[model samples]
Target: MNEYFIDTNIFMYAAGKPHEFKEPCVSLLSRIQSGELKAAIDTEVFLEILYRYHHINLPDKGADLAWSMMDLGLNVLPVTKKDIEISLYFYQQYQDRGVLPRDIIHAATMVQNGLETIVSVDKHFDIIEEVKRIAPSDLI
Candidate 1:
């Protein structure tokens, strides 16, 4: 099974509507269910998902969804001192290069783990070379 780190947008798309990528999103979830693909999610992605979902007024349900993903076997990457240090380094290095804190954390998580694929719809990953970004549409 190939392991992939999930970015927050994939979850949002799977949960929210615009419904353009519904099939692909469902396929990704199904892959996780069958254990063909190992899905990794970091604390930063978790916080972003909660914040964005609540920001859109889905407070109670957003939290419920977050917990559900965890229960569904999404591996939560533990935050370590090294992860923080790398994040800080990226914050300074990419500050003028237009990097967001959350993105830096995500990229750094991939770097630390030697993972190269990210399941995300966010284009910020395009700026990072450490991972290959796979969006929900690709799965569809």
Candidate 2:
């Protein structure tokens, strides 16, 4: 079984307003909850969710969402200083590839945790040669 890194956007799309990606992302999450898909997420994912929701005056909802994700039973990896350092290295190399800084950090977390695949809707992951990005639709 291939282990994938669960990107923050998966949770966002699943929880946010309805969009083209909502159903597929919700399905992807269901698979993870059912243990049909093996995945993990780093601490940074929680931070993003918390920050995004808090900015919209939903801090409690953000905390609840974080707790919900934690209850999914998937492995939660840490984002160490070393991961940030590695992200910097990736930034220098992929800066011209249109990769976002947050993505670089995600990639670094994946690398540090021995993961190579990510479940996300972000097309930017396609530019990171070190990691593979799988769309939620494709999985469901």
Candidate 3:
């Protein structure tokens, strides 16, 4: 079984009802649940998911979904001082290249957690070579 650091967007698309991407989300999530893949997320991604959901008027449900992910053994990788420093360095390095703050956090979190792959639809994950970026379709 492979371990993956799940991005915020995947969780958002998975839990949001009436989403057109539901099936792919379900399939990927099932992989995580069955231990065919282990999914991990840090506070940065969690906060992103929460904000995105809340912006869409699903604040309460977003919080609930976060807990549900925890229940499913999707480990919550915490942020640390070293992670913050790493993120800062990444931010400085890529700031001129137009990398956003959130992406830097995600990249740093993935590296700090020792995660090898990131399950994401976001292309920014490709910027960091420390981790392999796996699209949702790649999971198939």
Candidate 4:
């Protein structure tokens, strides 16, 4: 019953073409679907997945994927004003350390929700001491 914040890369890998991480990502997602694990994603993460799908000329697929994530019972956390404020602080604190703005927002979302574990392949999450990033393969 552990709750984990899911990052954008995890969804992208689960929905993308075959790759080394695909299988593990798929497995982790399947677990979520089966109610074996609890997972949540911020609005930014959902938008990132949708944008990537559309960017690749698959807008319909993007919509379907978004619906599917909802169907799988993924909790979609809102990006609140507080999250934005924290994101700004994170941005100023980690920008020079190579963390992107979106990554900062993701970290802020997790922090705001009291989530300390994130399922992501992105090493940038590691820069935030409040988050523990785990690759899908590590879970598998």
Q: Write the per-residue lDDT of candidate 3 for residues 1-140, one digit (tens) a residue.
A: 66788888787788767666666777898888877877888888778877877998988987898777776678888888888899999988888776689878878888887788888887876777666887787786
Which one wins by TM-score: 2 or 3?
A: 2
Clashes (backbone N, CA, C under 3 Å), per candidate, total: 1, 0, 0, 0
18-104 per-residue lDDT for model 4 (tens digits): 998889999999988888889999888778878888898998998888887887788889999999999999899999999999888
* Candidate 1: residue 18 lDDT (0-100): 68
Clashing pairs in 3: none
Best lDDT among the predictions, by candidate number: 2
lDDT, candidate 3, at 106 = 75
Candidate with better lDDT, 1 vs 4: 4
Tens-place lDDT per residue, model 2, 77-121, is: 989999999999999999998998888999999998899899999
How far residue 61's Cα lies from its native spot in candidate 1, in Å, is 1.3
Error in Å for residue 42 of model 2: 0.4
Could you arrange the candidates by lDDT from highest to lowest? Answer: 2, 4, 3, 1
TM of each candidate vs. truth: 0.89, 0.95, 0.87, 0.95
Taking every candidate in turn, the Cα RMSD to the unseen true structure, in Å, is 1.7, 1.1, 1.9, 1.1
Better of 1 and 4 by TM-score: 4
**Model 2 segments more than 4 A misplaced:** none
* Stretches of candidate 3 exceeding 4 Å from the true structure: 17-20
For model 1, the local distance difference test gives 0.80
Assess each prediction's global lDDT (C-alpha) against the native.
Answer: 0.80, 0.92, 0.80, 0.87
